[model samples]
Target: MPSETQLAYFLQQLLNAAPLSALYAMLAFGYSLSFALTKRADFTPGALFAFAGQVFVYFTAFGYDRLWLVYPAALALGVAASLAYTMLASTLTGSKVIRPLSQMSPNSVITASLAIMIVLMELVRIAANTRDLWLSPFLNQRITFWDHPGFPVVMTQIQIMNALAMAAIVFAAAYILQRSRQGRNWRAVSDDPFAAALLGIDPGRVIVFAGLTTAAFSAISGIMATAYYGSMDFGAGLMFGLKVVMIAAIGDQSSPARSAAGAALFGLAETFWGAYMPYVWRDLAMFSTLVVLAVVMRQERRV
Candidate 1:
């Protein structure tokens, strides 16, 4: 039988990361979309993620909450940002990197992306620090327990809503991807861009939509993250975005739902090991798992 403390810890870990997993899933799907269209992995999504949330906060400050403009506002910012990135990347390297090895070398593009992320994040820091910017206390309300056995889960109002919102957004996206014409186009584009283009599909349009969808999903995901903590801190998106990239890549960027699974597993591992192992082993354990996972997935992909 599981110990009482163990049970409590497990449930808390789930509760904490389930909603958080949605954030991961959203970001991962975003990355995956871009990968699907461009046939490349990139870090531009990372910058878009951070800058999008900042846009949300900025709009909310502008008194645009009744329609909950934060969501769309963030998406628009991301669209603009990702659009600019796509345009520049295409103009500079779209034709230059058609070699087989160039297909695997996202590092050069991602390196350039790092600069965008840094500049965007620094601007956010400067703005928030120098100007009047404060998030509304969105999560002060907490769900109360009925004081029953295994029934007392103290979740914040915002956390609960954010979680529900995450679920709704993911479900909607998944459905659209599976059922809509545009989504089918995306699948065809992802399946084989060259083949799809030969079939008269516009690869550039596919890519543009893919990037737009990525930003759209990121809007929902980023704001939910903002609501989860009841505060927005500059630079937080970078850490979380990196983890999302790692997890998405680990899943080969093919399984979008794996984003959620990856997040939950990551949370569970961190909680379990942190509780049972020495602090020195924590980071090692996580990285080791990542390495092991990469190796295992490679074997599967090989076959």
Candidate 2:
């Protein structure tokens, strides 16, 4: 049996992990949506994640500076801009670049996605002049669940809201994917594009549709993260994207539920590491574990 203090600490860490894990799960599910269909790990969604948040910050700043916008108005404007840009970019990329290149070679799609990621990063860097663009945090009131003297298990309102929102989004998406005609078309294309076409399903249209939903998920996570953390670095997208890719790959990428579950587990493990291990070693530890998992999974596949 653990002591009271140790139990309190563990509970506190678990509560702290919830929001982060939800964010990871949301991003991974978005990546998996299109990955399942195309089998191409188009990394632009990573850049899209950063891009959405940065765009939100930029537009909100504009509203504040020129329009004398209030908090609500600024937030609405920022969200609209972020979603619009993300949707446009995602749809165009899927229809024009990724879909065509994917047909040629998966490697080509990967290279193109990397190039797109670099371009997005550069655009964000140039827009911000390589400076930190910050947002004013809101809905950050801490809610204490167990006030264990010196070790209170606390969570913020925004964190709870974020977790609930992501959970709702994932469940809703899963439901739609499993029950809707569009879902059937998506799965058909994912299984075999030629077969899907023979069945009168337009694979290209399904890819574009998946891309739009991916954009929606990316914008949502990006906005929530920016709002919670007060800002996100534009350059963080690559690492964020790579980490999510690895996490989703570790899961059953064919199913959103499994991808989310894997991502949540990864998130919990990562948060625990940060709590128990040296902060500097957290990323190294997580990535190393992922690499080991990848090797093990590959070997198992071969065997």
User: Each prediction's Cα RMSD?
Assistant: 5.7, 1.7
Give the whole-model CA lDDT for all candidates, comma-separated: 0.63, 0.85
- What C-alpha root-mean-square deviation, in Å, does candidate 2 show against the real structure? 1.7
Q: Measured by TM-score, how close is model 1 to the native structure?
A: 0.75
After superposing candidate 1, which stretches have Cα over 4 Å from the reference? 1-6, 58-107, 130-134, 145-152, 271-284
TM-score of each: 0.75, 0.95
Q: Write the per-residue lDDT of candidate 1 for residues 133-215, one digit (tens) a residue.
A: 55666455767543335445566777777777777777787778889998888888888878988988897788766766666
| Tens-digit lDDT string for candidate 2 (219-253) | 88998888888887877788888887888888866
Backbone-clash count (model 2): 0
Q: Which residue pairs come into collision in candidate 1?
A: none
Candidate 2: segments with Cα more than 4 A from true spot: none
